[model samples]
Target: MSQAPDPTIHTLSEFLLHAGTNFQFFDLGRGVHPLDTQLFLDLENGLRPCPRPRQQHAWFAIVFWSEGQKPNHYIWFVKFPIDERGLLVAAARNHFLQIIVDALGQSLGEEKHDTLPDNPYSFVPTQSQMALFSAVTKSCLSLPFNDGVKEVEHYVNAPAISDWRKLSVQSIADFAQTLRDETTCHTVAQNMALYHEDFTRILLESAEAVSLPTAFKQHCAQYCADTFSSSPALALAALRALSSEQADTISQTLLNTLLDSKHADIHVLSVIAGRHYGQLSGHRLIQFFERAAALDEDESMEGKLFAGFFSDLVQLPCLRAEVLGVLRSTERSEVLARAFGHLFSQTQKK
Candidate 1:
C-alpha cells in the first residue's frame, strides 16, 4: 500500500493540501484581500516578503472545505508576527500548523466530521473588526451580503427608533460595503450626524477596509474634526478607521485641534502615531518631530510618545529614512538625540 503524505508540511499551502480538498485564504491585516496559497508559501520560504506589511503582524483566515455531512467548511482566524525582514516568521507559523497536526493526526483529508475544539492558534476579532472582515470576504468571494444588511439600513434611516443599540454591527458593515455606490454614499453622508455615537463609530470602523466616495469622506473628516473638539476618544476612533487618502486631511485637522488643547494628552498622540502615521503629511510629521524634540527637553511623557511613534514609523522604509534624515540634519536636543540613536541601535541589533 502506498504511504500517505507526511502531513507535516511546514508551509500553509502544503499543510492545506494534506488536510483538505478545497480551501480559500483571505488576508485581514490592513484590509481584506484574497491571497493565493502559492504566494503564501513563497512568503513562508522567504522567497518573497508579505504582499502588504502592516503593524509588524498579519491577520488571515482560512476556509477549509472537507467533504462531510454535518459541516462543510471550517474557518480559522489566525494572526502571525513577521520578522524584521518583513517575511513570515517560520516559528510562528510552524507553531500553528503543529496544533492542527496534533489535533487531526496524519489522515487530515479524510475527516468524517467537521468539529474543532477551542483552538489556541485562532483569534476572535472584535465586533467592528469581524464586521469589516465579513464584508470584505463577501466582496472578494463574490458572495451576497448577509441577511441583516437591510435591517441595519432600516435602523439607521429611522429617526423614530431612538435606540441605536437595535442595529447590529454586521448590518453597519454591510452598509459600509455599499458606500461604494454613489447613491448610498450620499445618503450616508447626509444622515451621518443624525446617527448616535455608537452607530457612527461602527460605520467608521467598517469604513477603514474599503474606499469611500469623496463626498462621504469629506463628511467623515468633518465629523472627526467636530468630535475631536467635543470628545478626543471618539475622534481618534473615527480617525483610525479612515482610509489612507481620507486620513490625510482628517489627520491635519485632528493634529491642529490636539495641539491647541491646554495640555496635550499622550494617549491621543500615541493613537495618532500608531494608527495615522502614514496619513500625516511630511510637513506635519516634521512639525510633530519638532514638537517631540521640544517635549523631550521638558522630559515629561515625550519618551512614551516618541517610542510609540518611532515603533510604527521605523517599520516603513520611507518613514525610517525620514527619521534618519531628521536625526542627521537637525540639531536635536540631547534627549531627542539619545532616543533616536537608541532606536537605530535596537533595530540593527534585531
Candidate 2:
C-alpha cells in the first residue's frame, strides 16, 4: 500500500485568507504588538526581513476565526528562527504547518483541540507577555468596553496610590500604549516615585518592548538620568523601557558614562547589553569592547559584565559581524576570547 502525503497550508495568513476568515497577528519576539500582515507576507516571501529581530528568532502569534465565531478564534503562538539576515527558515515553517494539518485536519472549529496533536511550536507566554497580548488582542478585536482601558485612563490623570494590586497589568500596557498624550506622560513621570517597586517592575517590562511616544521618550530620559544617581534599579528599569523603542540618545549617553568609569555597575551593563546593544553604533560597540577589555581582570565584576554583554550582542543579527570583527581583532581581551570560543563551539554543533 502507498502512504499518502500529509495535507498542509504554507503561511499562516494564507490559511486564514483561504477560508475568508478574519485574523490578528501579534509579534511576540521582544513583546507583543500588532504585526502587520503585509510585513509577514513579505517575510514569508523573502521580500523583507523580520522587523524586530532578536537573537535571530522572531516569535509571533496569529488569531483567526469565522465572522460569527469571534469567541472561538484559534490562537497559535509560534517562534521561528531566522538566518543572519533575519529571513525566516522556510523549511521550518513549512514543517510546522504540515504537522498541524496532519493533526488537526483542514478545518478550524471549537472541536479542533480535541483532535489536535501536541505541537512543538505552540507556546505559553509569561504572565506579563500574556497580559500585554491580551491588551493588544482586545484592541484589535474592538470588543466591548475594557475596564482596564477606562481605569488606566483615569489612573494616569488622577495620580492615585490606592493599591498596586487594584491595577490590572492590561491597564499598565494600555497606559504605555497611550503615552503620546502630554498630560499622561507627565502624570506617569510624576507618579513613578509613588509607585511600588513591583508595580514599577511590571510596567517597565510591559513598556520595554513597546514604542514610546516622543514626548514620553524625552521625559523618560530626563527622569532616568535624574534617578540613576539615586536609585540604580529604577533607572535600569526605565532604561529597559527606553531600549525597546530604540531610544538611542539617552542609552548612548548612559553607555558612554559607564565605559569611562573603572568600576562599572554590572546590572546597568547587563541591561544595556541585553536590550540596547542591537541598535548601538559600530563605533560605540568598538569603544565598549575596548573599555570592557581594560577591566582589572577576567574574573572581576566588570569582566563578568563584559562576558554577559558580549554573549548577548554576538547573537543579534545586526551586531553579529561587528562582534565577530571585534572578537577576531588582535586587541580582544582574554575574557572576550573565552566567550568567543564558546559561541563558535555552540554554533558549530548547530
Candidate 3:
C-alpha cells in the first residue's frame, strides 16, 4: 500500500500560495479544485513581471499545522510590511483580517471538516497576530475603511513571524517610545485592547518595549496582565508576564483592572471605578467593559455585565446611572434609548 503523504509542511509565503492558492484537497488527496488559480496567477505576475508595476504595498504571513488534542487547533497569522509605503495601500488596512480568514480557511480546507468550523480561528494568542498586524498597521496610510479595500487589506500587510523575531531591541524600544506620539499611542492602545494574545511575555521580553514612558509602559503591562488572565493558570501566567520589577505596581492596578475581568464581583469594582473615572479615562474603562461584554458573546457575558454595571452604575450621578436603572428593569428599548431618556429627563429638570 502507498504511504500517506507527509503531514508536516511549512506553508510560508511562497509555499502557502503553492499549496492552497486557488486549490484545495479532499481527504488528504482524493479530490482537488482550482477555484481562483487564474486570478492568483494573473495578480502575482502583474505585481512581479515587467519593469515593475510599482505596487502600493506589500504583506506577509506564516501558516502551520497545529497539532493538539480535541477538535480545535490554531492557525497563527502574522502580518508585516516591507517598505515605507506599506501603510498607503487601502488593502493594508483590514489586510490582517481578510488574510487570516482566507488563509486559515484555505490552509485548513477539508482537513478536519468539509464545512467551516464554527470557531475557525480567533485572535487568541494575539501577540503573534498583533506583532505582525502592528508592523503592517504602523505603516498603513491614514485613510478611512472602505469596502473595496477590505478584501486585500489582510494579505497586503503581512510579515513573516520570523521577521518580528528579527526586529532589533532598539526598534522595539523606538516603537514603545512612539507610544508617546498620539498616533502611535492610539494604535498601540487599540491593539492592546483588541488583539492582545494573553501572552504579554513576547511583547515584554525585548526590554526594548519598556522604553515607553513610565505611564505608557505601566498601562501596557497592567492591560496585558489583566486582560489575558482568562483562567487561574492563565491569570498566573499573565501576572508572571509583567516585567519583574513592574509586577508590584501592576498588582496595585489589579484593584482597578476589573474593567476587563471575567469575574462578576471584580467587574462591579471596575464599574465603580469607571463611574468615577468614566468621563476622563472612564470611557476607556467602559470601552474595556463593552469589549468584554461583546467578547463574552452570550447572555452569560451580558448577565455578568448587566449585574455589575447595573448595580454599580446607579450609585453614580451621571447619565449612565439612569441607563442602568432602565436595564435593571424590563424596559424593551435599546440601551441608547434609556441613555437618552436619562438625558431628556435631566434636560426637562433643567
* Per-candidate count of clashing residue pairs (backbone under 3 Å): 0, 0, 17
In terms of lDDT, model 3 sits at 0.34
Q: Which segments of candidate 1 are over 4 A away from where they belong?
A: 1-8, 18-21, 31-38, 51-56, 66-72, 106-121, 161-163, 245-277, 288-299, 331-350
Give the runs in model 2 whose Cα sits over 4 Å from its true position.
1-8, 45-56, 69-73, 83-86, 113-116, 139-145, 158-161, 228-230, 244-247, 258-267, 290-311, 327-350
lDDT of 1 at 47: 82
lDDT scores of the candidates, listed in order: 0.66, 0.66, 0.34
TM-score of each: 0.77, 0.77, 0.21
lDDT of 2 by residue, 9-100 (tens): 46766866765667878877655668788988877777777765555677888887777644666777887878766788887787677776
RMSD vs true structure, all candidates: 4.6, 4.4, 21.1
lDDT value for model 1: 0.66
Q: Which residues of candidate 3, in runs, are more than 4 Å off?
A: 1-170, 180-182, 193-200, 207-222, 231-251, 255-350
Candidate 3: residue 123 Cα off by (Å): 38
Q: State the lDDT of candidate 3 residue by residue for 1-350, as single tens digits.
A: 32222244222233345344322211100001111334323323333211111121222222233333422322332222223311222244234334434434434553532332233222232343344333323223121232323222221123222234444323442233233355554444454433223222333432222224455545555554564535443333233223321224443465345444554344333423332232213333344335434434444443444444433333332334444444344433344343434445654776
In candidate 2, how many Å is residue 230 off?
5.0
